[model samples]
Target: MSSTAEPAPAADPPSAPAPAPGRPSAPGFGQDRLWTVDEHLADILAAVHPLDPIELQLPDAQGCLLVEDVTVPAALPPFDNSSMDGYAVRTADVAGATEEFPAVLTVVGDVAAGSGSLPEVGPGTTARIMTGAPLPPGAEAVVPVEWTDGGTGGGAATAMSPAGPGDRGAGGEVRIHRPVEARAHVRARGSDVRAGDLALAAGTVLGPPQIGLLAAIGRGRVRVRPRPRVVVISTGSELVQPGEPLGAGQIYDSNSFALTAAARDAGAIAYRVGAVTDDADTLRSTIEDQLIRADLIVTTGGVSVGAYDVVKEALSSVGDEDEAGAGIDFRKLAMQPGRPQGFGSIGPEHIPLLALPGNPVSCYVSFELFVRPAIRALMGLKDIHRPVVRATLAADRTLSSPAGRRQFLRGAYDAEAGTVTPVGGAGSHLVAALAHADALIVVPEESSEVGPGTEVEVVLIG
Candidate 1:
């Protein structure tokens, strides 16, 4: 009997030396693969702590995380107000008034909103009131304003008295063609919310609707989670910032912009720190400055062992001694594209640093697979990851992955049918491939060969 229950499906086959036939390897690609996805993820997560304190103004605080609960200082609609523009009459006067034998009352003083007088509707009198106005004293029902007339045509039939015709001054009354019910058309005070009720709990992410709600409850300001400050630096001597003159062999620096946008979309304030050449000293100095003012630091390129690669060396310098120069941990994971992902602390400040490989596609993939979720959690986003689904492959292709590492292939997800299909050729440097992909197919480490009909899990990217 096998002890491991079906051999637990190998994550991927170990990379054989001289590499598997027909598969191309980057120059000097080693036979030994370093970190596993789970291993590196654990290390990365261990280095990060929740973000620090922040206070945002209420109007500008929509979509901001709440650091404290917001309770209603007072009941909604603080006082009993009318819900309709109608006549406010004493219930006693309209008790027996019906269409056949209507009760007639005199109309009294009109109560528009913001009026402070406490006008009372006596027995045979009524008061004209507007919606949202406080219910006049002794008012029982509000017959819509459209239902009442001047009453001059019927010889005082519209002119009625208050208190069922008891005292003087005509006292303003309402003619009721329909029988009255207790409290009908009258909105009771605090009916929507009790005084001092808890409107929202701590850690709540405020939305426009929630902001409106808070405003309704009289809260002009609210204490909310501070947005993390992220500095995105794209490193490459051959790159130029967008809108700048492109020298020979120079490509537009897009990683920094894309990553910055991604960070902002995750609810963080991001700054692009410009590009750095492959020089180790320059990279180190740039990161140090960013670290002092930044809560999160992300750098693209040079994480691999290529001669032009200095990100790995710079990161290694930042890792704890046995003291590397800095205190960062740099290693290649057993995955494609993002294989050379680096995570660790930098300088004396202990700033968390994530060094993604230079390949645009690689950088984006690593961020989506790892950093995005972490950022969302810190920023208190409701849905941490893009929705994923299981589906069958639409086409078949053979790709080699380390037996111990899982592979994430760019693809598209058909949500209605719950199927995922690869969007383009599996090329790590193909940025266009990523553009067309809507999701990522998670091919297991043991999946040496997957046919079109094979059931697989996909991580929705779009």
Candidate 2:
């Protein structure tokens, strides 16, 4: 050895870092690039914003969120009306009236629903009013037609069969047998909702009942966040159409159908594209073609680091900053079945695309974990994910999972017992098991094994 180390021989040109023992030096297929589910979800959601509110007709606004507080422009009933097909008479006129001693009154006229010409009832005069027909000017009460012998002394009448003016009261005289109180069986103006009252709050979801209420308040069209249009694509060379015969190495494409239904269940209008082959150019071109109709894009498969993992290879250069849209990024998450994923924007409009694993179970789980929330966010919904509940394990054996990965095992939840039973094993290809599962039992990353009676979090998927 020279006197101290002959001037450190030019620090041997900084050799490149060595790859970890069994992991790739690059990001793909490597544990070093794994993302937590929450981390990936947060990133996907940060880029998503609610769609602009538009005035859509009542028929088109179903499942959409209301943007503004809808006020009742006019009273819900608009005017006093009869709630049943009966005689409209003054309460005092029919006092103590019964079948034995009936108060006979002259039939002024017949009132039908939406009739503009309403007769005024005065003193002993009465109007045969149909349900929803506006109350006559002087009427104070209404008695069912059954109580008055159906104006025919015949058997009980199911309805007032007088559809035309010619058939209006062939029975000239009407006898009011039973007595009625003031406003009896009458729908008063503003009884349901008054003018200027709130018909629906700003964030109300427009279901059938809500739409009916808005219509009752004269809201033919209202401002609402429109339903997102999701385009679902499945990429795999070994995939075939659902009805078509499969070859030796081919499988029917189920991810597209499953995810499309899932997206619709999450309140998006979903369109499914048949499986794209394992070619990068074909997948990229197909996505470009679908961009015009897509508010969000979801693709399953071709995201892993296999030789034919075309989603990464194809969409990696999908968007350029010089163009109008952005690029897609693939990521691996620290979760079972649904670890391989991708999410980003693409095309001129910069729509969001979520890439899930190709396996059927993994694809569906990924949808519930990620795509559903993204769709809800686009629809301006505050609650995004499926509600999770604490449930006890009903399994007889302890469940095992990988050390550092959060495991979501398919489960059948018994709501009454407040327990969840695992459906299948830890295999990601257990599609049949997934079909039987109504929920997912979430086992935390730190807890590798769970015994019976252990309380676990269950996410409702049904």
Candidate 3:
């Protein structure tokens, strides 16, 4: 053997075993292998886009997204107006007036609200002004009518005075019992909103307050983002419409109604697309029709791997032979109550479709967790998601969860202790539990066990 130990046997290169047949390829090194709630959400959002803008009148502008900036049309209170029903006087003249030693000022003229005519008050003169009346020239203050006794009651007293014929009556006078500050009881012009100032900016979601702002700015109509129209359907032959007689193993369809309400609350127009059986052909036709007619389509049920599961199979069939198949892009999210979720573009129109689980509670949770946020984003809402906060456990308890999945458990939030107590059993099929819960407490994937006094992030539902 040549010296040097025949060059230590050539080290064998690290080998990657081939992927098992019918199994997905192993994820690249350093890349994420499992779908997180956020990752799946990003993929779902990357599909359909927002709608175009439209012009709508104020009567129809409720909940519409404002597309343009609104500026103050004119200064509020076009002119300095009186805010009190009283006598307008020169502050300098009444500066020392009091009940004991009153200031006698000759009554000049009266100014009513909305009157264009205004007269100047000379020294020792006062103008009778009503609330909302423009301050007359030379008037620097308002003395409430209650503080002034017997004003020039419209100058008619001079004509009706008890004096001999051909003898002119003396002009009536008023005694100022109190002094008021200059500009008192007056709302200065442009005080509320100055002209040419921006009152509302673009992309503002118009609510009662914003609508009132528009009216104040003299805007009778506004341009806004079009309301996203959505169609919701429930699939499952075992589902029956409410108010109808139920047969064996059948329950009333609730997910559709719940989702529709959720969509509207998110600022989107929602319409029921009706229910469909487990047949692939029927579902495909129904979904196609909905895609052609709606901006988005949402359905519950038929997405799992059970024998009755037909949604995923139908979607795969539709995607066949098409470069970008209309097939549903199902995401097995590492989240409880909403694992069997699907998102994809539908048909050539590329309308967004989201398929949620059929469980009544799961569908509702998925809508709150995913669909509603998307709708809010499209409608230009600022607070798109429900606010989340840390809460303590109300009682000692155990929550079982898969070692690697983030679990969302329904519970009630106690404001006093800033804690959330789990509501009912930890099963996704618990509809009563869902109804009683006021929030969803989040348990991170890394923690398989959590005990009392441990801080947790909770989503307030109520």
Candidate 4:
């Protein structure tokens, strides 16, 4: 049997190849007419490219890829400042000081942060300095208030009392109970970063820390690959919005909400459109209207051969005649539960679109296997696929799969135990099972049965 484990999907510069000759076609597909999962994924990735980088405010650029290296315009801290609210005095003045026989110094004035003017500290004198306050001239070190008498002329004081409205007199005395070394409790200039240093490199993903660093370096705006705007549409006449009253044979539209949330989780700015009815004209017009704001379009349902398959009928000839890379290709895949699929570019801009099956589990699995990677790729990320691991199958009975088809079964992966147990049966409509599953158990095309304790390739979803 051929290896079922496939490498992580990457963008390849080739269209999907046709089915091999003399190969038995899966049921409902014409003889030797089916595409492999890798082929479909490659085609989708190859067609989609990263969005152009744009300058955005720091807040808006969070989670985006930096397109250029950000350099520090000025050194961090800007100047030598106090790291503590304490007395800024010459190091020699505090030397040999002790609690029993402390060194007394005159408190000339207070030095607060952002103070334009300063008090110069001469020998036998010190200044009361707040945290982050610049060291006054002639001061070589800072002695924390805890190590001094806080100018109260008592035992070692715990804190400095604020001067009242009428108590603004700077004529006080402070007793230094301990000796402080040079630069003690003082932040040296450029200690964190130097001017012209590369703060962040290109291709770096900007997280909270990175954003903070950019702001620290005075970068109010930055250049980054913007998040792709994905428009998700679920098509079906029988589908109704959630929280609305349900009529006969009408089911709540979960695919749009699910796929929209999935797109966001994949680092996209996703918009969930109201479900479209089973009319080719409405579907086509809806897609055309969304093109103005969409970087990628995803639709669920109506890609199969059913007579009422609106997606296939609507998008079959969607490309403009003048457009080069347009038109959708509806094809069956050699996979279980998600055989019917459609992918191609449409509209004047030729935005890429993916049409998935209607079944809840199938639609969701197809999204993880295809849409997530596409979104990451559009964000200029190199690693676009979910993590995978090899695990032993933990099933009571042997698992059965269809030959010549790759089946992805939802499973509960016990990472600590390194075992994965299948969730629910092999039904594509099992949303409850999919909800409880954190991984997918892969069954290769050539293998129809998998016994317990056999190792299998598991895709970690959660």
Q: Give the whole-model CA lDDT for all candidates, comma-separated.
A: 0.69, 0.81, 0.74, 0.83
Sort by lDDT, top down from the best: 4, 2, 3, 1
Model 2 lDDT, full chain set: 0.81
Off by over 4 Å in 2: 1-31, 152-159, 166-171, 321-325
Lowest summed-lDDT stretch of 10 residues in model 2?
1-10
lDDT of 4 by residue, 247-363 (tens): 998888988999999999898999999989888888888888899999999999887656677787788655463565466777667887787777777877878888888888889
> Residue 267 lDDT in model 3?
84
Q: Between prediction 1 and prediction 2, which has the larger TM-score?
A: 2
TM-score of each: 0.78, 0.90, 0.79, 0.89
Residue-level lDDT tens digits of model 1 in 224-307: 766777889888888887899999978878788889998887777889988898788888778877776787788988876566
Q: Highest lDDT among the candidates is held by which one?
A: 4
**2 against 4, candidate with superior lDDT:** 4
**Model 3: residue 320 alpha-carbon error in angstroms:** 13
Taking all chains together, the TM-score of candidate 4 against the true structure is 0.89
Candidate 1 wrong stretches, greater than 4 Å: 1-33, 91-105, 148-180, 316-326, 380-386, 396-404
Residue 2 C-alpha lDDT in model 3: 4
Q: How far is 401's C-alpha from truth in model 4 (Å)?
A: 1.5
Point out where model 4 deviates above 4 Å: 1-32, 153-169, 319-322
Whose TM-score is higher: candidate 1's or candidate 4's? 4
User: Candidate 3 lDDT, tens digit per residue, 1-462?
Assistant: 000010111222343343233212222211223456776666555544557788888877889888898888899867998998777888998987888998888867667787676768889888777788899999988887777775655423232222244322235688878888889989899988999989888878789998887887788999988778889988888878899999997777878888898899788999996678888888877877676568878889876657777887666555222634344566566777677777766666566678888877778888888888777766766677898999987756667666767788888999887989999876666778988998998888888877888888999878
Winning candidate number (TM-score):
2
Counted clashes in each candidate structure: 39, 0, 0, 0
